[model samples]
Target chain A: AQSVTQLDSHVSVSEGTPVLLRCNYSSSYSPSLFWYVQHPNKGLQLLLKYTSAATLVKGINGFEAEFKKSETSFHLTKPSAHMSDAAEYFCVVSDDRAAGNKLTFGGGTRVLVKP
Target chain B: SQTIHQWPATLVQPVGSPLSLECTVEGTSNPNLYWYRQAAGRGLQLLFYSVGIGQISSEVPQNLSASRPQDRQFILSSKKLLLSDSGFYLCAWVPTYQETQYFGPGTRLLVL
Candidate 1:
């Protein structure tokens, strides 16, 4: 079975400061990890994904995440947080062995960017 | 490019009312379609998924049912809405042999 856990339910950061959202996963097979952001009342937008390629993956809106095999973690980061960056982020894991590529989603982390 | 569409952007229904939410994918064929529900302040819960027309797999057992009448169209229905069913419903699609799922704008459902 594959599952994901977002370490923090909420993270507050000042505008222009760094932001970090932590996630950890458990999967039997090599997993495909993804980071998705959802603005208030909006649909989820894919920020980035790690499919066993580069350890460091860059995504839109200056967001990036590093996949650590040893740590079993994929933590999202932004060097500088913008006001628009305030949103809810989800960490998802997919196991190829699973039928239909079903995804397991974390509880989500809500980021608050204070101006 | 592939795009997913969900209708009834916002719905307010009473308990025991019938519910139907439609989702259609454009620019993709024989794709996998899924329906997810996000309760307030909670993560997404996989409700159902379909590999092809008339093939649906339910991940959770609740007061909901799904159908894929067409290759690109997936419908979620409920014979009666429960207060627990009130949440955001999202439709997503993944292309054949692809692992990435694209989501639609989602329909906000409020059961009163």
Candidate 2:
């Protein structure tokens, strides 16, 4: 079984501050992890993915996540938080060789950025 | 660039009403397609997926069904809408040789 856990239900921070959203996973097989963001009513946008290559994966809009196998974690981080960065974040995991790439999503973490 | 489109963007239907949602993809061929639902303040739930025309794999068994009549066209239908069916539905696709899945604009359904 594969599952992802986002440690925080919500996180609030001021602009220009470092941002961190924590996630941990449990998977029996080698897994592919991803970070996705949803702004308000918009659909989810892929942030980054870890597929056993580089542990640290960079994504769009200055977002990134590090795949830590020992801790079974993939935490999203950013040096600065823009107002535009306020959104819902989801951590996902799936078997690297799954038939349809079926993804198991975390409950979601809502980010609020204040100026 | 590959693109996926789902419509109508927002829908309100009465319970027991028949529902049909359409999704289409362009700029790619024989792409793998998926349908997922997300409830308010919840994560995405996989519903169905298709690798080719007329082939579909369902993740959740319910009143809903899916069909892929064409390579890039996917349809979601339900015999009758339920209050629990209300949610945001997304359509996504990945090229056969690619590993990443890209999503469409999504359709918000509200059942009353």
Candidate 3:
């Protein structure tokens, strides 16, 4: 079984400040991790993905996430926060062992950027 | 470029009504399609997935069922709607050679 837990249900940050959203996962095997962002009533957009190739992954919108196997963590981060960054962030884990690469999503962290 | 699409951006239905939500993918072949539902302020719940035409797998047992009649088309259906069925439904597709999935805009179904 594979699952992900988003540490924060909501996070608020001031503009230009660093942003961090934490996530932890439990998987039996080496898993593929992903960070996705969803704006209000919009489709989910992949921010980054870790496929065992890179421990530190860079993604769109100046976002990045580091996969820590020892810690069972994949935390999303950005150097600076922008108003447009306000959205729901989800941490997802997929184990090929699971049929069809079934993805398990975390509860999500709602980010609020204050300008 | 691959794109996923879901129909009836918004729907309102009464209890016991039949429900249907359709999803289609373009620019891709033999893509894996998935259906997910998100309740208010909740995480996504995988409902169904299809690896190919006429092959559907249900992740959760509920009033809903899924059908894949075409390679890139997946449909979710319910014979009787329940209030709990109201939620934002999303469709996603993973290219045959890709691991990351792309999502559709989603359909908001409101059951009364």
lDDT per residue (tens digit) for residues A1-115 in model 2: 8889999999999999999999999999989898999998898899999989999999999999999999999999999999999999999887857787778899999999999
Q: Is candidate 2 or candidate 3 better by lDDT?
A: 3
Candidate 2 residues B72-91, lDDT tens each?
99999999999999999999
Local distance difference test, per candidate? 0.95, 0.93, 0.94
CAPRI verdict (incorrect, acceptable, medium, high) for model 3 = high
TM-score of chain B of 3: 0.98
A1-72 in candidate 3: lDDT tens per residue? 788999999999999999999999999999999999999998899999999997999999999999999999
What is the alpha-carbon lDDT of model 1 when measured against the actual structure?
Answer: 0.95
Per-prediction fnat: 0.81, 0.71, 0.81
Which candidate number has the best lDDT? 1
Highest-DockQ candidate:
1
Which TM-score value belongs to model 1?
A: 0.99
Tell me how far the alpha carbon of residue B14 in candidate 2 is from the true structure, in angstroms, after superposition: 1.0
Better of 1 and 2 by DockQ: 1
Residue pairs with colliding backbones in model 1 are none
Which stretches of model 2 miss by more than 4 angstroms?
none
lDDT of 1 by residue, A5-84 (tens): 99999999999999999999999889999999999999999999999899999999999999999999999999999999
